[model samples]
Target: MSEFIEWGALGQVVVAGLIIGAGIPALFALGLRLLAGTTTQPQRAASGTRRAADGGVPAGPVAIARPTPARLVGAIACMGVVVGAIAFGLVFLVSGGH
Candidate 1:
């Protein structure tokens, strides 16, 4: 009886893993489609600034610069801290910790 129950549990886990593995690509494709549908095409930057007939300076900066490495790292660190806090809360709840 115990052996039969273990086999059933193992079969359930195998079936669930197979389903999840099969679903991952479908889910990824669906997410891509949704993202593509919702996103607006970005406007192209002007190749060269148009100058006044009198030779005036260009109005704005040429290109937007990328964030510095420190800023990017700080932002990622903040996100990790938030996710870690949420995970700790979930673990505490599941473990019945006060």
Candidate 2:
């Protein structure tokens, strides 16, 4: 029975499964986090804007600051990798996994 099982192939399958299953979602989440950056008070709020009420209420709408150039680039790269991986999988399936 041991002779019939290909350990090398099994190992490869396990590694691939872990990467495609866990790695892709991790990268995607990272990309989303980088893209969102953070929310903060707007620069130079207009005088008309009322201040937040006492009790932790926000004075005005908080704005999400744009991601820095480096972070933006990193996010794009991560998303690109995810998309590429998905496309590759679809193509592979269509090609009969040859």
Candidate 3:
């Protein structure tokens, strides 16, 4: 046996740390991205009037963005994973996994 290090254990720790530390943030960001996708299309003015010769900004009601069902599902799924990971960590800490 090596005096200062066990390569197998060290490797496991490194891999686990990478996954838990980096992966959680990545997942959370993914969730936010999924949830925040714009689903609104540019809308024309409700009135039939067209823009003037200057061609300035059209006078119209603001377009409102709503989340698509798929995006909502994806975001919920990603957030669920993040929340589950947090819950698992808390449980692990309470159970002396440290």
Q: Which candidate tops TM-score?
A: 2
Q: Pick the candidate with the highest lDDT.
A: 2
The TM-score values for the models, in the order shown, are: 0.35, 0.76, 0.70
Predicted candidate 2 versus true structure: per-residue lDDT over 1-98, tens digit per residue: 38999999999999998999999999999999988868876555456455556444435556877899999999999999999999999999999995
Better of 2 and 3 by lDDT: 2
Residues forming the 10-long window of minimal summed lDDT in candidate 3 = 54-63
lDDT of 1 at 93: 90
TM-score of decoy 2: 0.76
Which lDDT tens digits does candidate 1 get at residues 1-98?
68547888789889967755655445545443333322333344365554576255444544444555665555555555555656886898999996
* lDDT value for model 1: 0.56
Rank order by lDDT, top first?
A: 2, 3, 1
Structure candidate 3, residue pairs in collision? none
